[model samples]
Target: MYYGSVGGNATFLLNLPPDKRGLIHENDRARLSELGEAIRNTFRTNLAEGSSAQASGTMSGHQVDSIFDGNPDTYWCPEEGTEQVTIEVDLKAETEFNLVVLQEHRYSQRIEKLELEVQQDGEWKPLWIGTVVGYKRICWFDKVTSRYIRFKITESRWCPRISVFEVFCG
Candidate 1:
């Protein structure tokens, strides 16, 4: 499988073909390199403004907790306060997809909540939700059919801080 670290505190899982999977253990160097390229491309396209580094750079733990305190539309939660961050995605086919969200707590000992949503009938609906403890990572998967996708961060104690958030699609 190809895993990407982006978009949230999760790993985006991309299932590889049988041949590719078989080579992972015996030829991990080449397999990992290919996987890295795929992940980079995925982030380049899905992140806001087609810039993953830029998007990530704008957020911190303080930013996340105070997002609503400022302009909700333009303000970003601090990487530490980012209860959850998501991206709206356009998929060509309906399939089971998986991704990981990694949360790095700057002060808090645990994440309050993390979630994913899909646009439905002009509304954003929840597709999945979970919790993370300490400074750890979590994984989630679901079958979805949508042209647009977004990540939702619900609750956190800190104000800002994040190392990275990426997405992987298949």
Candidate 2:
């Protein structure tokens, strides 16, 4: 079953209960398919609208930083051959901030031990870490109160190619 509304646009997929499945006529599959399509279209529309607003620059740089794609040069994965991009954000006087890193792993090999780091006291410190498996698009979000921020791709068995990096302040 699926359900959604514009203001609280949400969709859920669930397996039919055994009793319900047994009761459904073969022809009912067509109606289920139609409902699935409608819910998917609604989600697509909402996503497109949100993306459009961010691209239009109506959103503040800080608020929309998660959606911003920084220069490609700012990323470094072993397969990318020494290409590393670093962004430094000053959080002076700010109580909180977030860093969003988007990466695409397209190689057949998987990446292991992905991590993000922040600069503290002139040293790099780990903030978060994870693993990337197969052809996955990884979005990493880190929230901190430090005065400086940066990202570190700690480990990769294949290659880590990032599509974008953005920092937001709050």
Candidate 3:
């Protein structure tokens, strides 16, 4: 059996019931293989590859590196009570990409307003600006070539701390 659900309160889950209740019969192997392939194709490329990130500030014991470590359990949080925070990613070289993905810390409403920018002529130019909520946000815009990406948190929740699990451009 394959089980998943989303609820009114931003709930999402994938679970397997008891052995007898959720058993995957031998015939299901083919279906599972197809599902696996679909997932692989969906994430075939991650533009954040070979990139390095830096943030304006990080809360004690939480480092900026956690944001790109591919682990949702780890996160990057700005200093307590910070008014604004900027996290920058160096793409190593100019590359064309149209998507910026931000995954926030689970169960937290931290980011309110975000601005996506690229370094152009030594100045940061806007690519997209919008409000964000929930655990994930995907921003799409016209493709741009730049070596650096600046993710600015212009507004945040009451704590005023910016916390995120992962950020990428693709």
Candidate 4:
């Protein structure tokens, strides 16, 4: 449920059976905790960190290269009047990854739709299309081995302000 819902960009409801006392079974609780820990361990490292990052167009203060700094306060924004833009991340070498994390600054959510693509064999191939990133969105797909990845913002309420973009292997 967690992987499907998160990867498909939908909210999910996980149900765990509870007893008459409104307490979950011991086994179920333990399993749930184990799953949570596994997920945490999988994403503990951001493989895209410190990779070369650049945007099609960049706003002065909100330079796109800062997206990997890990600070939620600083963000990357495209030039004014630009509703669509692309940010390319160079992994420095071929990297294998299956998950991506996107975060929007807390002030507002402007992104309406975006697509992720990978450069394979000198060609760009689509991976996933995401919608409405409010605070944070976690997307996962089949593992991809590539040196270059692109984040294309197709639709937005305005110039999209992105705080963090990260990639993880899972």
Best by lDDT: 4
Assess each prediction's global lDDT (C-alpha) against the native.
Answer: 0.45, 0.41, 0.68, 0.86
**Window of ten residues with lowest summed lDDT in model 4:** 3-12
Residue-level lDDT of model 3, residues 1-170, one tens digit each, is 11111111234443434356577655566666886686466457776765788988888878877776777677778777875788898877887787666767777767788788899889999998877645656666778888888988898875433333222333
TM-score of 4: 0.88
Task: For candidate 2, write residues 48-167 as lDDT tens digits.
Answer: 111211111111222323323334333323323332333343434433444332444233333444455666677888776655433332333455666555544445543344434333
Model 1 Cα lDDT, one tens digit per residue, 1-170: 33223334345565544464455454656767876887566544322122212223234333432221222233334344444444344443332345534445344344566566766667887776765533435355665555444554465556323333433443
Better candidate number, 3 or 4, judged by TM-score: 4
Q: Which 10-residue window of candidate 2 scores lowest in summed lDDT? A: 47-56
Q: What is the per-residue lDDT of model 4 for residues 1-170, given as tens digits with 9 covering 90 to 100?
A: 67666544456667777988899988888988998899899989999888888899999999886789988789999888889999999989999999888877776678899999999999999998978776777878899999999999999987888888999998
Off by over 4 Å in 4: 4-23
lDDT for residue 87 in candidate 2, whole number 0-100:
36
Native-to-model Cα distance after best TM-score fit, residue 57 in candidate 1, in Å: 14
Off by over 4 Å in 1: 1-96, 105-110, 133-136
RMSD of each: 9.7, 11.4, 5.7, 2.2
| Model 2 segments more than 4 A misplaced | 1-95, 98-101, 105-110, 133-143, 166-170
The TM-scores, one per candidate, come to 0.41, 0.39, 0.70, 0.88
Report the candidate with higher TM-score, 1 versus 3.
3
